[model samples]
Target: MSDPGLPPLSRQHDRRLRQMYRSAGWPCQDTVEIELLAAGLLERRLEPSGREYLRVTDLGIARLAQALDRNRAALDAHEALVLRVAEEAQRAGRIAYRGLGLLAKPGERWLQLRPDVYSIRNTSVEDYLEPVVHEIKVRRADLLSDLKKPDKRAGYLALAGECYYVLQQGIAEPEEIPPECGVMIASASRIEVARLAPKRPMKPGFATWMVLAKAAPCRQPLEPEPRL
Candidate 1:
């Protein structure tokens, strides 16, 4: 058979290759196995015990390194988009919080909801604290997957005075999001507000209060709220 042209591997493919590099007994998915073999990234070798095992070749390692580099670059770019949104919010005098985790209960450590970026306008008892949540969507597949989680949106609505979807240009249509949600676009040059989010301040329950409490001063310095 002729050689199959090697393309940039997905994160999963790169992970599998790394697993193979570490251990010959690494489990292989059918598609990954076929692609790795065809792409000349992996091979089956007989061990001293006569057991056949999969291993990543030098070429595979090189490709995995390249894949890792690409993954890092993509992550950096995505993070830049997130940072820009936060900066905009802050410039408007909103206190920005990135990766704020909302839990169902104060005792639980698990996240019930995690908005990519969220902000609270002012910090004190001055006026009603308006919470705005931002969900960043860089890929359409990821956006579609998130839209399926109605509970997440509902959770945000419970706490948010406004919720906006910060997305890549053309990645998602405004209709794809719920009517209650607003949309914004983050591109190479600037972040634009396509649809302004309506203010619908809700009575924040204990959990929502916990989210805001954690957002104070800075996202990193604040600790999780103690169980009430």
Candidate 2:
């Protein structure tokens, strides 16, 4: 529970924090964008140092003053939503996360990456486990925008680990005691445990072969040319 005197994380606070980060001139510009959107501030462009950008808006400074007076407990409570949902999903035999997604690659590099709520379920079939993919989307009524994106989800999935559950939340009223929320689930998939196991050291001959492979590219093409 938040302190009685503490204020909630309003969109106003979000804008203020963003202004703070921007004025500081951090190299990673998206950090400010992510923080602002996560806090539900006015949606802005992903660009850095826009032509109309101001060091700090009058409204932003006022909000920051109010935030400084409030207890920090509210901020901690709000961020815990991610771990809380993951724990609940784990109890139900599902892997869940708040804002992790997947990325897909074209050729050797990823073309797009998307981030959202992701979950996976393990399915058993004749002693084998397969992973089922799930995606969660959040849409706020006031904003009329769906926060879910495929690239984000793809990026999360591309990572080495697997997650089996997801919960999406959209806050309609930033000032309300409990912000409005929504959730969705992805269909479950079986997980392959054997593949995740660490591999044993190879014999000398195999080790030597592996060293050779690493030292030089394969003589033949890895893939056939695509048909026109």
Candidate 3:
């Protein structure tokens, strides 16, 4: 539970947080939009194009000022990219999330390597399951640092049906990545597929299937019915 005085922010609040502040163009599924409106944090106004716009309000600013500490706890660059990419993938029918929907084993050892982020398309046997894995690289040094680890390559290739390197825009060029892997840039306002990842299934172990079995639409079951 959150402190009585603190503005409500926790793991349960991620969807709400993103709903209230993500780009107006970004899709929202949670009731956070409505809550923000009720709290006077957001106003439902029309854009020049006649589309509804949920712009922040002065009262919302005041509320946010009181939530400065909580906001700081909630926002971070690495997770921000993960959130954007995950949300985008969900929109595209990808739901299973690493460390979320995709759970690690009860007593896992160093041999099992988890992708920074990943999603599964479907779980049905006859249907082909698309496993998309992403390695979030916020800093060039972090990217270079991981490059030295040979296991990272072997791990991703064995688990991901399609692999992607999700980096901040201008952080690295698409040419830096191989033709098989895709390159996605997380821009300030949006996530762009700078390069499409090629599809290739890698034979995975039983541990991998365990993770895929848990794939669902979004973390919030009541939210938008995941198209997945």
- Name the regions of candidate 3 deviating beyond 4 angstroms: 1-75, 100-110, 202-204, 212-228
TM-score between candidate 1 and the true structure: 0.77
**Per-candidate TM vs. native?**
0.77, 0.32, 0.55
- Per-structure clash totals for the candidates: 0, 32, 0
lDDT of 1: 0.75
RMSD in angstroms, candidate 1?
7.9
Lowest summed-lDDT stretch of 10 residues in model 2? Answer: 190-199
Provide the lowest-lDDT 10-residue window in model 1.
Answer: 102-111
| Model 2 lDDT per residue over 1-228, tens place | 223444455654455565555664333355544544344433343346463332444554555666655535444533444344444445556544444323345246664332233333433332222222333222242223333433433443443233222322333322321111222322223211211211222112233234323442112213457899
Give the number of the best model, judged by TM-score. Answer: 1
RMSD to the true structure for each prediction, in A, is: 7.9, 17.8, 16.9
- Model 2: lDDT to the true structure: 0.37
lDDT, candidate 3, at 27: 28
